[model samples]
Target: MARVDVRLGRRVRDRRAVPLAISLALGLTVAALPVWATAHPAAARIAATTHPSATEPVGEPGGGVPTADPTDTGPVPTEAPTTTAPPPEATPPAGTTEPAPTTTAPQEPAPTTAAPTTGAPVPSPSVPPVRPSAPAPSPPAPPAGVHVTTDDVTLTAAYWNAPSTVATLRVTVTNTGATPARIRLAYTLPAGLTDAGTGGCAGAGGGEHRCGEWTSAPGARFSTLLRVRVSGDAWRRMPLSGSVRVTATAPGAPGPATDDEGFAVLFPPGPPVPGITLDAEEVSFDIGGGSSGLAVRLGNSGRVDAEGRIEVVLPAGVTVPAPPPGCAPAGTDRTRCSLGTVAAGRTAELRLPVSATPEAQLRAPLSGAVLGQLDPRGGRARQLRMSFRITAAAALATPMVSPPAPTGSQGVLAAGTPSVGDGRGGSARRTAILLIAVSTLLVVFALALATISLRRRLAVPSAGPPASPKP
Candidate 1:
């Protein structure tokens, strides 16, 4: 009975084990179907994503392909900058950096660099910052050696020869400036004087007259010193001077007509001896300093052409030209001015300039003597000395004089002719001059005489009215 019961149990166990095995197998198979389903779906999705559709592209293994998504750009949408700034310090290598050859600013994306303007801001294309550079410095000033200065000038004169026949003048100049300058000296002689030498100075053709009575010597012209009165080519030291013009720059600017010229005080009249004479024998000028010229007129009181010489004495601080360049002197004194012959019946005139410290004080009187060489005798030289006060500024002109009538010892005058001629006599013209001179003198003398007479008249008492007419 035990064996049989055991067999029945075994059969039941076997039945249960078979069914369980079968059920387990079926469940494993069902789970395996899910894995296969998941694989197939995943494969289909990967294929779809691999190739981009109209809306999107697939993700690649290494890099994602661009997608044409409505929300995203085909690639990535990029935004450009509104403006770019240049590097504050853009120092390129010395050789590599070039000065912007063109004045125009580099053609920026936008084009507008027209600037007289300063403190401007410029925009540039996007670029990396450059290193800052140092600015260039300015050049230096001139060295201490170059300079310019005035030439201290000295002048001396003398009158010599019969009847003051010759006038001699000498001048010297000294340098005071730094730097060796190629010096030149020039000056125009006062009118009425011809040139004394040649090759040394410039010349003007004023010495000769048109009446054909005067002849200009070969060297006649304006005065100037072509080169310094130096011995050799070497530069002479400053403070050196000779009978020459002390020069600086020329008169005018550098050009074709430019010349080495200077100004001087002369017998300021042009084409001199335009037939003139003083109303009287002499006129006095009491001129001070700072005067540029003196004016005067003369009337023709006689019949023949007349001529005369003039002399001037400068007060302290005043100056008279030394032997001026291109001037031929009639006498040794540089101040002596000569006017050619004036017709006997005509009067002549002139304006004279006096040199002085721009502002000098003139005290001593200015005396002028007009004498006609009426004869070879000693008394024939007529001289009139007058007094004048030099004014700070020049005044009106001097009145002209005509020749006086025939008078004084009669004989040929300086012109080497008869003392008196037909029509109104040259002597008459002289007389008129003499009368004016004498009258002027007499006026002064009369004043003194009158003062004395008045003093005496006042001092002498009446004799009690002659005792009342003797009652």
Candidate 2:
């Protein structure tokens, strides 16, 4: 009997154990379904293997037990009410003790339909800050050392003569720096002067008359020669002056360097055509109180006519009467003659009468000078001189007379009678002798007649006179 009972209890325990193992296997498969679906493409097949349809009853063909189905998803429902009965308790097999059961909380299931969307919000991608770039700088300028100057500057004269003359103006440009430079040279001509087309210069600038441009190397020099000429009546009123200017700079320099120089002009005197030549004869004077005469001749020796005033200066201790026409007093002891244009090769005469005062001495010299000019505003004048003698008053007053004239029958003066065609002048003398003879005969006849009358008177004597003769 004990054996039969133990066999039956073993059969029951085996049945319960198989059902509980089946339920636990189903739960674990369901829990693993979501992970399997995510890692594989056959998610529907995995769901079918895990949960059973709710409409299907557990242990349909066997004793009361739960089982898995492949189709529907609703909870299984109980059949129509039959009887209200409690479940029966199970008994442990002999020789073994039953273990106490443990209570466990239910766990939430993982989603199998859709993926979760609300994980930690993804942070925006990190980025760094930005900044702006700067522009490049410019290069620096060149250094300074250049010069401009002249050559033989002392040769630049301040004054000139004649109507025109030639002059040299030499300009030199020097570079006293390490780098090359450029220079501009120029000059200004005074009125009535021109630049004689003779220079080593490049052509003039566009708007500047005498300026030019050039380029030079380091420590190099350049030169230009200018020939200047004078013209017109420039020397008549005043002289003309010219000037030069030089400007220097580097290739890209900002400002310029400059220098200046100047020159002047003048004129010389003219030639003689307009010259005068004078001549005079020697003169003599009585020492104390007497008069004398002088004659002077003037010749125009120049090619051009002589005009302006001609003067004659006299010494002291001499007296002069009224001067000839066209002559007047010109300062002390001087006489001036107004000569209007005396033609070339022509001659003119001046007659002057002079006297010596009581203070005059014998052998005293009488001197005279002739000063003449052509144009009062132009050329230099000419001068000439003559000398004579003075004599004592006791000398014969023999008047200095000119030669006798021809027979004009004006006045008969014996001392000035000129020799005629023949020598016949005795008739006037014979007539004077005849008158003297007649007067002598009259005196003799009168004396003889008086003698005859006396003889007659004696022959007829008186009566008483004859006797008295004896006594």
Q: By lDDT, who's the top model here?
A: 2
Query: RMSD to the native, candidate 2?
Result: 86.1
Worst 10 residues of 2 by lDDT: 77-86
For 164-215, candidate 1 gives per-residue lDDT tens digits of: 1122222222121221112233333333334443222334343311100001
Q: Cα deviation of 88 in candidate 2 (Å)?
A: 99
Candidate 1 accuracy as TM-score: 0.19
Candidate 2: how many backbone clashes?
A: 0
User: How high is the CA lDDT of each candidate model?
Assistant: 0.29, 0.42
| RMSD (Å) of each candidate, 1 decimal | 55.3, 86.1
- Candidate 2, 390-436: lDDT as tens digits: 33342322235454223222111223332222322223223323433
Over 4 Å off, model 1: 1-290, 296-300, 322-334, 362-385, 393-471
